[model samples]
Target: MIAALVSAGAAVPVAPPGLHWSACASGLPQECATVSVPIDYAEPRGDRLDLAISRIRTAKPELRRGVLVIIPGGPGGSGLNRPSTYVKKLPQSVLDRYDLVSFDPRGVGASSPVSCELAPADVTQTAILPWPGPGGDISPTVAWSRRAAAACAKNGGPVYDSINTRNEARDLDAIRRALGERQISYWGVSYGTYVGAVHATMFPGSTDRVVLDSNDDPDPALVERGWAASYAIGVEDRFPDFAAWAAEHEEQYHLGTDVRGAYLRLADRLDRAPLPWPGANPPVLDGNTLRSNVLNGLYSDARFPQLASLMSAALAGGPLPPTTAAPEAALQNTFAVLNATICHDVSWPRDLRAYARDVAADRKAHPLTAGMPRNVYTCAFSPGPAEPPVRVTPDGPPNVLLVQNLRDPATPYRKALNLKRALGDRARMVTVDAGGHGSYLDNGNACGDAEVTRFLTDGTRRDITCRG
Candidate 1:
């Protein structure tokens, strides 16, 4: 058993002892263990938090190269369950060569989870994302941000303040030491891309083959802030794919040949008179909900049918589509971590007028998003970061491979290039001709998957664009 090693007056070791492994309760073919890390790395002797880690060993032990760690998305996303989940999708060749491993970062599931204790209404997607009022007014968003920020401050305690991306990178290094691996490979998605990049920059020698899928800009001045604002550009890039699909299926969807125009008109109509949704959290299929659904639908082509059906139902005066509330506890934890990471990572402008102007401009420019991307977040009211943001430098070895979809809604292609620019020659990209949040092992594009698989299995390197 892993002893209760960290305590008052105890000297924290330079490297933690090996993890005490056991069969996971989930009954998947993976082992589970707990890794104890300091809440504050600067003060290793201080309070510690437990991180849940999991692993699936390579069957071909003689051919095994190293561990491939899966870093999950969102400041709140969990990775402890990934080993079992990814075993199905991962290629046998890659599985044969590397053990699949993952962990829940602090403030996420199975780790030392933190929560703001936010009310159910406050943690809704509409409230958390900062969507502006109908006429592009951001005053309400500002008010909500302030309230949420205060709740997090009062309820989140010390662990919340320690949940920045830099510290997450530090936790990764700690995991490496506990695993006793000289080097490990990583596959990071969405926000995980930023975390992975920071880890590589901070501990370059510890990383072997790195794969960053669906990346975001790593601008030091604006890390998480830039990611929030990129939704406008991402929506614009990916909406066309949805629009084209909806337009082609107009006969079935019944949104007319001008599907985009129909969508805007329907949204405006719903803004004035929302249909009652029986089981939804807010219990209304309002304009903001419609817009939010569109943003989510653009994440994958597969979800297009569901999005279209929702719109079609609303447009045709049929029954409002059903909605399910995310688990209240999970929502609270996710909201807290999101604010803790983004708000504590860097300082955000506190001027509401400045945010108002940005929202106004963004709403006028991108009607689809209605200025949510540029609106205020809880970060505006939260404290500045404890340390400067980690700058992703190009000094690392050239073992990083970035695979991006041309029209990813969450991390648009244009912004993803900024990360490529930040990495310089240390990384190469494989831009796939597809539209989704994840490119490799997702979107089902053979060419894109082949490139990433080749790189992960062996040390293949190149900069290329894959076509459908």
Candidate 2:
């Protein structure tokens, strides 16, 4: 039966030959290799690109089960070094049973990276993410979106157009073939979860135990647009966690007992009179900047102090926190891939008035986000997708497990429900009673970790909520 399943309609590519293992340049214990894949899967014999891959073989060959791929977050995230980083965190049972593998998706990291050649100003995190100006005005965001769209289209070429989630899945399949594995298991986080879901849907027969952690909404109509807007819901869901922490440390932060009110008041005050932050990307700390920082800080409990410190400094009108800017080349690569993938994967609404209306409503409904979630993106100005978004459905096998934090700031629990509903009985979800992004091995949630570990090692399946 397993043989029949493996032979039936599975897209095991023959083009990518077996990988030649060599010590990674990172000086880690893992081995690295490159897989040659077509830029356009439809034209397999056409222009090709190289994908960087890394893996750590299980020391206990006797306990070996199969290969487990680590799919990283950020449409532009690089997983080439994940095998090395995660080796210490993953349970010994998992390490002994599976060879941990990862890769830099095409257009990311060492895999023929693409750049939009955007200006340093445009490459800033605030610029790339489409945050609105003061008073929920999206005119600046609109202008930036149009300029960025043109720049990327002019510079990205065919390679940019080819970088979508579907192709990424095809790349994963190619990796599976190169490893000579009939079935590959994976642990996908954030945007990687969407990639994993699409892969499972597109090539169910080739997948083994699938673990989608910190999932995204798999809404076909609003693929990445939905993800962009999810921040509004996610932030609201996770802010109370931050608020409670701030309330506990009120004497240090001095934001008063009403921490939430203090946050809102300070954000509005900064909006009216921005603080000049020298050496910063935009060189100013405003309402949106405060909100963005809070959103980022809510990703983990350890980051609460950082967010609190920034708030305390900002509220006191004292010296502002120093900004740590990323390298220009890295930012260019990330923003380019982010734009290329999101824009090419699905179509976004091009109407400016529509965005204005949504932003206005969203700003009123969720002031903490300041309408950024409903604002315009480069996709609004870019060309339509070559193909429709892949629909994640329950047509696949029931070997998938989804582990989620109840209050994930980036991928909210409410939206993750959409993905869970889409998967139907094909998946069993483990919702952690936590207030951060990642679950399973992360957040120190022993219950969630044990569940995921057992599933990966012995194919155990159970749907239970874990208290963090």
List where candidate 2 sits over 4 angstroms from the true fold: 1-17
**Per-residue lDDT of 93 in model 1:** 94
Candidate 1 residue lDDT tens string, 1-468: 111221212112345457899998778789999999999999999999999999999999877887899998997998998999999999999999888999988989889899998766777766768988888888888888888988988999888889999999999998988988767889999999999999998888777888999998999999988999999999988888988999899888887777778888998898899998777767788889889889989999999999999999999876976778777788888888888999888889988999999999998898888898999898888889989998898876787999999998889899999999999988999999999899999888999899999998867879999999
Residues 1-468, candidate 2, lDDT per residue (tens digit)?
Answer: 322465432224344447898999989889999999999999999999999999998999877877899997899999999999999999899999899999999999999999989866677767877778888889999888888889998999778889999999999988898888778899999999999999998888889889999999999999899998999999899989888888899888877788778888999999898888777667788887787788889999999998899889998885887877778898898998999989989999988999999999999998878888899998888998898999998886788999999999999998998998999988999989998888877799899999999999888887899985
RMSD of each: 5.6, 2.5
Q: lDDT scores for all predictions?
A: 0.88, 0.88
User: How many clashes in each candidate?
Assistant: 0, 0
What's model 2's TM-score? Answer: 0.96
Supply the TM-score for candidate 1: 0.95
